[model samples]
Target chain A: MEYIQIANSTPMWIAAGVAIALVMFQALIFARKSYNTGKTIGMTDTQMKSAMKSAMITSVGPSLVILTGLLSLLVTVGGPMAWMRLSFIGSVMFELMAVGFGAEAVGVNLGAGDAMTQVAFASAVWTMILGSIGWIVFSTLTADKMASVQDRFLKGDTSLLKIIPVAAMLGSFGSLVSGHLVALNKNTVAAISGGLIMAIVVQLAEKKELKWLKEWGLAIALFGGMIVAAIL
Target chain B: MSDKRRVYEKDYLPYIVRYGKATGWLAVALSFGPAVVLAVIYGVLPPSAAVFAAFIAMASAVGINWFVEPISYFPIIGVAGTYLAFISGNISNLRIPAAAIAQKVAGVEPGTTEGNIVATLGMAVSVVINIAILTIGVFAGNSILVRLPEHILEAFDYLLPALFGAIFVQFALMRLKLAPIALGIALSLTLAVNAGWFNFLPGRPTYLITLGAVFGTIAIATSMHKREARRD
Candidate 1:
């Protein structure tokens, strides 16, 4: 009857599996739809496959990071919910913080021995759910609308409109990089090395028509950047 | 409208909108279900008041991110990706970078319809592969993590900066002039925020830095693009 037992229960695992299945189903359908749409719009199979390959490789390192985070969540919230949340709709940091807040509200501490009563478990669940509800609800309401709103502003030549996304990419990414740059830690070394390596690799890829190298460009930069930072 | 835009915006987008809204609500329901199921089984649902308190605490902590992240991210990921990314979570670390690499390998630009399609497909592949990795890790493969050396684990701390560095370089190389401006604006604002100059603001300083970088870079870059086109 322990709450932790319920957390790692067979029913919990079923729910987790079902939830992850839903996510995978949606992804499959979207991929199929996009692939078909791409064919109509002049995308070759090679290009689409290469994009998929690049994404798969780029995802491996970060996904491993998430997996490492999963180890922590396993101890805190048990395996099922942690697996479901990370697989479907939540990040490690948000879930961990919510669990902490929920535990505190009930005068119990998390990961501080077995103070997790049934109510404490429910409280944590409620906080995680309600906390993240805003995103799904907001997207339900606004995801469709935002794109058209963007399209409205970008009504001119579509070619010229390309600048909008490019600038947004730089701007969003610039903010991310700038944070590390100002921190002046190993992160600065990591970021600079990644950027510098990318600059060189890309120049070489284009100049020499290194298709294989170009395809693996970001993955190389990612690990290379980290190795440089680690050595420093 | 251009042929490409017309196909995406007119012919294809409505279908995405339909799928997005339908599945978005389903995701909300699925995500919220586990808490209720566990509570009902234990017959120890936290009292409504306690649940409300936990909800309030979480909302206050991350409420702004719920609204802001989707909007900021929509530009790069586009419509299908908006639904897919928000529903699946891990938007910044996994999804956006997945899209970026896919576009790079496929020789597509981020803003165009083609890039959007490529990004969507790439993200779909990433989620599938990511889930496969997590499934193994949770069930029987976290042995993979426990055996790693301490220094190797330390490398992951730099993963974010390294990934960001590479992505920023890609977009910056495309628009060399505007990249520095974005980095400068973001660094100043972020440093100012770090210095406690912006303590009065709501939510994380990241939003301020990102919004500043994105909007500021967009304004300058758009004008520069236009003027260059005019001369040409």
Candidate 2:
């Protein structure tokens, strides 16, 4: 069979579907367990329901972004592999580079017409699989250990424990924002606009105690900033 | 620890760890299974040399982040959330934000059992939503994207920057003083790198800059926190 035919084959779809189903199953299991745990911990059903609603709303913009990424990947890797990879461990940012490295190793430019052979495509798949396995391996081996590590770090000061995670988030996000802001392009504009928008929305939400504003703040900032940058 | 907290750590966490281990191994298999299937059907395996090169290239690019992310994000999302987020992908873009927003709206502080449960619920909902959108995108294929106006595609480019910016502000508001300090460190390092002032540093300076910002802010914040405690 031709490379393109194999890329979008029925068998590939089945394999991809099975992989996706496993992920969904894992998520459902975890969610159910956590929900039961929440009840034991004295969390109200209203809290759980509100959290689910807020999370669903928060996911819309990012999901749309992932969709954009999927569209781009589909053109290169076809529907099945792209769908499966993106749904499974392949982040939108990392998948392209993994595919690129694989294609380059086989002396082909990915997404170029007739350049990617069956061998090259196989190489790309292998690279994608191999490259991401480290995350699973490291996390599997060490995730349980983190609970103890956090415990040791806390040294009985639970308040300090909260600060550490909050600081980590701040630092990581600060660095990410800086990377985009340095470019002085539309990206920088978007970043600034988005930050400003979020600041305003958060302020309003806090001052008014508006649950809806807090829920929709990120999405509003993201789309609003993007629109503003595009216009400018 | 309180009896409830102890019970959680002793019983619930062990359960989470067990399930996490099982799911982690299963995820590894599922991730690799697709590549194996494609290789067998196509009657082509990537050459040893190609595999080696692709692995090295791809691994070098993401290796550090693979280790760093789980550690950084563990406290915010908890054990079960980490397992699911890492496997499902989109930790930063989708899962983390969803969890964060959910916890916030539910009025649960992160790093607690209730927080972890809320985060898990949020992540599960986000995962389902992401998969649904992706499946739609896959079935729709390129036609939807192909027919999109150029300006809309252009706007998509700003989405990530906007997202990072908004998320940064959310965290920054939590630590008003330290946030700017971290942002300043990252921004300065980013500028220096762009100016070719960091020629001596190996690889993209962005990684180093990010690390520096995170540690630097932590140091500053910790000292300030300690001083405030002493004063109190």
Clash pairs, candidate 1, are none
Write down the DockQ of candidate 2: 0.71
The residue ranges of model 2 lying beyond 4 angstroms of the native Cα positions read A111-114, B196-202
Count: clashes, candidate 2: 0
Candidate 1 structure quality by residue, lDDT tens digits, B20-133 = 788888888888777767866656677777777777888877887788788877777888988898888887788888888888889988787898889899899889988998
Tell me, by lDDT, which candidate is best.
Answer: 1
DockQ scores of all models, one per candidate? 0.75, 0.71
Candidate 2 per-residue lDDT over residues A1-232, each given as its tens digit: 6677888988788888888988898788877877888888788898888888888888888888889899888777778889988888768668888888898898997546447788888888889888887888778878889878878867786766667666767777787788788788999999999999999999999999998887788789989888889999
TM-score of each prediction = 0.96, 0.95
True contacts kept of each: 0.78, 0.74
- Candidate 1 residue B211 C-alpha distance from true site, Å: 1.4
